[model samples]
Target: MRESEYAESRADFVHQLRIAIKEANETQYWLELLHQADYINKKVLNQLIKTVLKS
Candidate 1:
């Protein structure tokens, strides 16, 4: 691929990565809120936490 093509690909990757990170952060925030409000059981919350940490 040409140098410009490679640069464009890298930029797209970085943009996608930033979006994923933002969404993950938002998910964690919601999970925490749900747990605090007793909307989620301890076991389920623990499982979710483990899954999120692993990712």
Candidate 2:
């Protein structure tokens, strides 16, 4: 292959790598947020149950 073709391929590879990394990071962020939200929801539900039982 030619030097120019190699350079273009390298550039494309880097671009795709960056996009993949961005997507992975975003996915991790969402997963973490979901876990935290679920935890909070459980805690709230437990408190609600306790309050109802006391009433």
Candidate 3:
């Protein structure tokens, strides 16, 4: 995420932001999958999901 801060151009900053968003979405997906598979409990899932969304 901090990569965007060091972007050399506005275009690069936007590109970095896009990459961050994509990664965040992927993290959320995995969290959901883990929750469904019972690898994580509701509390942990909620905490992680909240953190990801907040990012």
The number of the candidate with the highest lDDT is 3
User: On residues 1-55, what C-alpha lDDT tens digit does candidate 3 reach at each position?
Assistant: 8899999999999999999999999999999999999999989999999999888
Predict model 2's lDDT versus the native. Answer: 0.55
lDDT-better candidate, 1 vs 2: 1
What TM-score would each prediction reach against the true structure?
Answer: 0.69, 0.54, 0.92
Higher-lDDT candidate of 2 and 3: 3
The deviation in Å at residue 42 for candidate 3 is: 1.6
- Summarize candidate 2's per-residue lDDT along 25-53 as a digit string, tens digits: 66555555655778546556556545533
Clashes per candidate, residues 3 or more apart or on different chains: 0, 0, 0
Candidate 2 collision pairs = none
Candidate 2 lDDT at 5 equals 37
Error of 1 at 3 (Å): 22
Clashes (candidate 2): 0
CA displacement after TM-score superposition, residue 19 of candidate 2 (Å):
0.2
Clashing residue pairs, backbone N/CA/C < 3 A, model 1: none
